[model samples]
Each structure stands twice: as structure tokens, then as C-alpha cells.
Target: MRRGTGRRAMAYAAVVVGLALSGCSSGGGESADESAAPTVTQTVTETASPTETSTSPTTQTPSGSITPTAGAPAVDGPVVAQDQLSSPSGNIWCSLEYGIECEVKESSYQPLPKPADCRLDWADNQFRVDRSTGARGICRGDVTFTEQPPELTYGTTSVVGDRACQSTETAMTCWDTGSGHGFRVSRDDYQLF
Candidate 1:
């Protein structure tokens, strides 16, 4: 009878150990499945606020058009009208009231010969000033004037001016008040002043 009781107790302990091991194994399997399961992830994007965007100033064009925060230099002087260009030398006149003048010259100092065929022709804001060597013609564009002359590129040359000029979508114009020397180009109709 005593041997039989010991065998029964040993059997019960074995059964308990087997159950505990099975439970642990099952728990590990569940944990592995949870780890392998797909997880939901989210992403977010942010945009700048108006106040943050407005840190830079706005630029206004000669045509009364406003470009928002382009960071372009502001025009220091008033804009001259297209029809107002005039020169004291009667060669080219952009605007006398605006103090903008253009003249044809042989060199930096020498004026173009009399009857200098210095004339301005334009299509919209785009213009070509025809003149003798060193002669410049002044004209205005549809865009607003800036302190810095707007970039007026012609062929391989990048036109720059000492005086004020404005840039537009179609074209740019400069007063060329300093040297009075026009731009040199192969074409008879080229942007100079």
C-alpha cells in the first residue's frame, strides 16, 4: 500500500510539470505571433504658416502687379511711362520728368553723328533701340521699376545698367543714364537701354 501511494504522488507531480511546460510553450507561441503581426503606422506632414511665410517683404512690379515674397530688390525711384522717354540730346528720350535719358554715342563721350537714326521700336514691353555705336535708347516696360536694373538678356550678353530699370514677364528696360552707351548686338533690333 505504501509503494502504491508513492507511485500515485509521483504521477501527479509529473502531470503538473507537463501542464506547466505546455502552458509556457503556448504563451511563447502567442507572443511570437503577436510580434509577427502587422502593425499600423501613421505619418504626418507639416506646412508653413502665413506669418512664417511673410518674414520676407513683397515686390511690386511697374505694371501694378504684386509678386508675393519674391525677395527682389525694391525700386528706389518712380517708374517712367513708356511714352515719356526723352533725351536732352534729342537722340533718345525715355522720360524727361523722370530724369531718364538715352542717347546714341560714337564712344563713351562722343555723341552719335547728327541725323543719328536712333529710334525705339517695341512690341508690348519688348523693345529694340536702334542707334549708332555707343548710342543708348531708354524705354519702360510693363513691370515695375526696381533699384537694381532688371536683367535684360540679349543673346549671349546679360544687359546691366548703372541707372534704374524694371523687369517684366515679357521684357526689361534700363535708363542707361550713366555711360549712354547702348548695347551691341548683331541684330538691328536689340535691347540696349
Candidate 2:
């Protein structure tokens, strides 16, 4: 019995020593200094999302850089009938003086071959429309179109009698509205249609 008690006392001493050296992970073992220490945490939130409001989309017209528009062009001023008009760049001049006609101060197209019967500075610079000669070039010593007419803003159409002329960013076009015959002229080329 004495030998058994001696063995038990040695085992109990070993358990006490182990318990003192081992880590106690529970809150019960945390000291006041460790428990009082603060832990830092960071959180982020976002606000302000982008939003946009839009309506009708625009369409591009044949005239370079021109956006198609609907309804009649806003009339900022009176539109004179049988009046003259120039392109935005003033490179072209057109008139409703006698007929729907236009002329480029400089052009690349072949000038009308001067006829032996005709005496004038043969000019391919001018193009005009008439019922008989749908559209044709002129031989002129000097005439209307190159004479610098009033400015006609793009997207605006001027009508006088059966003739109409419209200036655009890229070209100037004139026609006999009733017959649908016309000419379109730009700096380098012209079309009589």
C-alpha cells in the first residue's frame, strides 16, 4: 500500500508540471493586458453609379459629315425666292436667278468643248438644269454663279417657282423640283442628273 501511494504522488506531480507549461487557449487563461488589447478591422463601401439619358439617334446623309434632320429646317431668317446662295466654304456659288444653276470657282471635270459656233470663255465650271437640256455645262465669258451669291446654310432648301437649290457641307445641288432634274457640284467634280 505504501509503494502504491509513492507511485501516485509521482504521477500527480508530473500532471501539475504539464498543466503549468501547456497553453490555455480559452478566455479563462487570457491575462488582463492581452484581453484589453484592441484589434483593428477595415471595411470599404462604394456609392455613386453612372447613368445616362438619350433619345433619337442621328443618321448621316450623302453630304460628308452632314447629319440627317427631320421636318423643315428651322427658319432663322426669311428665305428669299429667286435668290442667290453660296456654299459654307464659298468655294461654290449657285442661283435661282434664271434657273437652278451652280458653279464651282475651280473644278476638275472636263470643260465643255468650245463649239466653233459659240463665242465665249468655254467653262465646264458651271452646271445648270432646264426642261429641254436636263442639265448641262456652260461656255461663258462671265456669268452668274461665280459672282458670289448670298450664303445658304446647309440643311436648308430654297424654292422659287419650280426650281429649288440646297447647299450641303460636301456639295451644292439644284433642280427643277417638278421634273426631278438636277445637278450636284463640289470642288473637284460635278454630276448632271
Candidate 3:
């Protein structure tokens, strides 16, 4: 009986030692759950976002940098004759008068009316005097094109009455008689294109 009590005491001591060793882990440190305990937790929330957009207004002009519109005409004549261009065929007259140089271009190359200096023929949208001593055609002076960069000036005279737009760099003084004849005069550097 005494021997049996001795063996039981030894077994109890071994169990205590085993429990102590288990408390101290293999790395010889306390468990992670005990060391890391949450102290404070913060949550972030976002509100409505602002809208970003451009506030500039749009105002569009013609192609050229500076385009000056012709003021309201004092006389009563259509600047652009839509009615005249309705048919594929119509008569349009352009007369240019520069000092000591004057000419007229018509759709048809008819004989010059009495008192007129000469009669010209229209060829390839251009009318040229068959025989003339001076430099007088329909096109004369400086010209600027809205679609092009470099401006041009013409010394020769040739008729360009059928073009959609007639432009000249030179200044022109124009007056419409309401009749078939429209008067255009250029002085010195003045030109009709």
C-alpha cells in the first residue's frame, strides 16, 4: 500500500509540470490573443461630391479674323439676288470703272451698245476685249480670300462676274441704280475682285 501511494504522488507531480510547460509555448512567449486587444476603431464615410464643368459661352464668327459686315444700304436693291440664280440660266451684269480704265462684263457677249467704247466676248467665265490698246479687263486690284493665308493683288483686268463672292483688297465705292447696271468705282489702289 505505501509503494502504491508513492507512485501516485510521482504521477501528480508529472502532471503539474506538464501543465506549466504548456502555459509557456515553444517560442517561450504569451499567446497572440492576450497581447493584441482592440482599443479604438474608427469608421470613415463620404458625403456628396461636387460637379466639375466648364462655364464658357460659345459664340462663333466667320472664317476670317476680322470680318466687317457691310452696313445697311441706303438704296433699295437686293445685295444677293436669289431669284436671279433660281434658274440654271440668268443674266448678271458687273461693271467696274477706274480712272482712265473702265469695262463691263455681261453674261452674253453682245455688240457694245452705242456710246460704249468696246464690245467683248465671254469665254470660260471670262470676257476679254478682242483688241484693246490699254490695260482694261474686268479684274483689277488687291484681293483677299477667306480660305487662304497670303493676300494677292492683280494689275491686269479680267472679268470674274460669275464667282460666288467677289473680293478685292483695294477699296471700292459702289452704288446700285436699281436698273440692270450697278456702278463700281476703284481709285488708285482700289480694285474689284
Candidate 4:
């Protein structure tokens, strides 16, 4: 699905826009990858306590334990999507092939440690989740910010299958279509709800 150049980001860097992010970069397409993700120990607790924590998810995933509390939670709206995406500033990027996987080139918040079972790279700046699931860091050897996919214009969003990602001036917000729950990431911090 990595077959194109990135487009320019729009002016509304703070607004939340949404569209289907196919690989074509014309706001079309769906997830084409289905390899089972590794189990991640990060858990999604329904409790109001953001202090909750756990052990793993299905490989670089967020299903085992963790509460998302980065900045004040703010999920404005949906953004268009492609198989992959770049934030307008090029500081963040994402891939929706398997739910939504995103990473920030730079951030300020301290993230959870790598799940014990994760053998790949585990970082606080790396985020991953399935549609309808809570957000967590990803344990991966690859990155989504390769600039191979189209850029998700500021204020615009990209969605493939059950996932959607929105690029804004402050942070990139993405969520699972079924649960409406997702996470937000930026150069300074991240939040999951």
C-alpha cells in the first residue's frame, strides 16, 4: 500500500476533518494487511482512574492493560484516511492497515514500558490500537512516518476500515469506529480515552 507521494497539509491545522484514506491519496481505500498483531500487555481499563496499568496486547497492541491519560482528552471529529498518513507538519505519521498505528518523531510525555512479551522496539512515542479499542504504545521494528503515504492535511482526517486518524496543529487524533475511543499524540504529549 506504499505507492505514492504525500500531499500538502491544509490551512486549518487545528480543525478536525475526516475522509477515507485509501492508498490512492484521493481519500479512498481500506486496510490491506491482516497479519495478527503481537499480543500487547497494555490494558484498557474502563475505570475513571487513569492510573490503571497492565501487561500486554496482541503484539504491539493495547488490550492487556493501560489507561490513556496524556493531555486533557479532546476528540473533536473524524479525519479522512489512507493506508498511511503524515501529519501536516510532518512530525507525526500513521498506518491504518491493521487498525491504526501512529508515531511521533518527538514527544514530551513519559510512556509505559515495552510489554514483557514484546521483542520489537517499544517506545512512548509509538501508539497503536484496533478499531474500538483503547490506545497504547506499539512494539514494532517499523515506522509509519516514512512519508510513503499521503499527508493527512491539518484539520483533515483519514479512515480505513474501522479506524480513522485526524491531523491537527497540536496533535494527531485517531479512533476505532466501533467504540469511538482513541488516542491523541503530538510532539509534546499523548492521551488515550
Instruction: Give the winner by lDDT.
Output: 2
lDDT of 4 by residue, 27-101 (tens): 345324322111111111111123335545643322211223343233344434367888878878788786677
Q: Flag regions of model 3 displaced more than 4 Å.
A: 1-51, 54-59, 63-65, 68-123, 126-193
Q: If scored against the real structure, what TM-score would every candidate get?
A: 0.19, 0.54, 0.16, 0.53
Cα lDDT tens digits for candidate 2, 1-193: 5334555565556554534433253447643344222211011011111133455697533223222222112233334453788888988888777776677887776666767866877666677788654455676666674357778888676767766677677777777655667777888776666
Worst 10 residues of 4 by lDDT: 36-45
TM-score of candidate 2 to 2 decimals = 0.54
Q: Which residue ranges in model 2 land beyond 4 Å of their true spot? A: 1-82, 145-147
Q: Please give the CA lDDT of all the candidate structures.
A: 0.32, 0.61, 0.27, 0.59
Q: After superposition, how far is residue 4 of candidate 2 from its true place, in Å?
A: 99
Between candidates 3 and 4, the one scoring higher on TM-score is 4
Candidates sorted by TM-score, best first:
2, 4, 1, 3
The CA lDDT at 18 in model 2 is 39
* lDDT, candidate 3, 122-193, per-residue tens: 222222221121122434233211122211122212222221122233322222222112223233222221
TM-score of 4: 0.53
Model 4 off-target regions past 4 Å?
Answer: 1-81, 141-148
Clashing residue pairs for model 2: none
Steric overlap count per candidate: 14, 0, 4, 37
